[model samples]
Target: MNPTIRSLVVPVTDLAATKAVYSALFGEPHTDESYYVGYNVNGFEIGLNPAGNGGGPVAYADVDDLDAARDALLAAGATERDAPNKVAPGVRVCVLADADGNPIGLRGK
Candidate 1:
């Protein structure tokens, strides 16, 4: 696996307000995908996903092999949810629940 984060998606209650805050903090928007707004900081990508649909603040860990990453995290005390499945057509993810029930996601290209 590459073991590098491709992007981090943050679920916000107020889309416009959050976008404005991130825009100010990052200086400008790199890309906006309607469902998502991306900002580049150095080389890392941050995405803002609108609230609803069981969405929440998501922490992403990018991996060359999403399945492998999911397996490893599962071995290390993280509970897998929905296995490594596609969130969108090309974007794949493994949903995990931490010891405290906090959500963490491993993403793959």
Candidate 2:
């Protein structure tokens, strides 16, 4: 599958404050939930996650096959942080950590 970095997730300490900041910056959120807030900017997604890494932001690449992409990462020395899980009706996401323990996310539909 061709990988495209379509999303960038930022870890937030305060969801409401973070959402407001991003809303002002991005002109409003397309997705607003207790756990996540998503904004669409020129077809790219910027997400705020309450349960994100404190270290830094996580970048997500869009893939045609979530499992295949995840497995390839694992084979290349990445460790599974979260298995493939359905977040929406047709959307599936998986999180993995590189050798240095940095988080990377994969999203598929």
TM-score of every candidate: 0.74, 0.90
Which pairs clash in the backbone of model 2? none
Candidate 1 residue-wise lDDT, 1-109, digit = tens: 5576567778777778989999988977877766778888888888887742344667788777787778778899998654666767777876788898788888885
What lDDT, from 0 to 1, does candidate 2 have?
0.89
* Among all candidates shown, the one with the greatest lDDT: 2
- Alpha-carbon local distance difference test for all models: 0.76, 0.89
Worst 10 residues of 2 by lDDT: 51-60
Where does candidate 1 have its weakest 10-residue lDDT segment?
50-59
lDDT score of model 1?
0.76
Task: Rate residue 46 of model 1 by lDDT.
Answer: 86
Candidate 1, superposed: residue stretches over 4 Å from native? 51-56, 81-90
Each model's number of backbone clashes? 1, 0
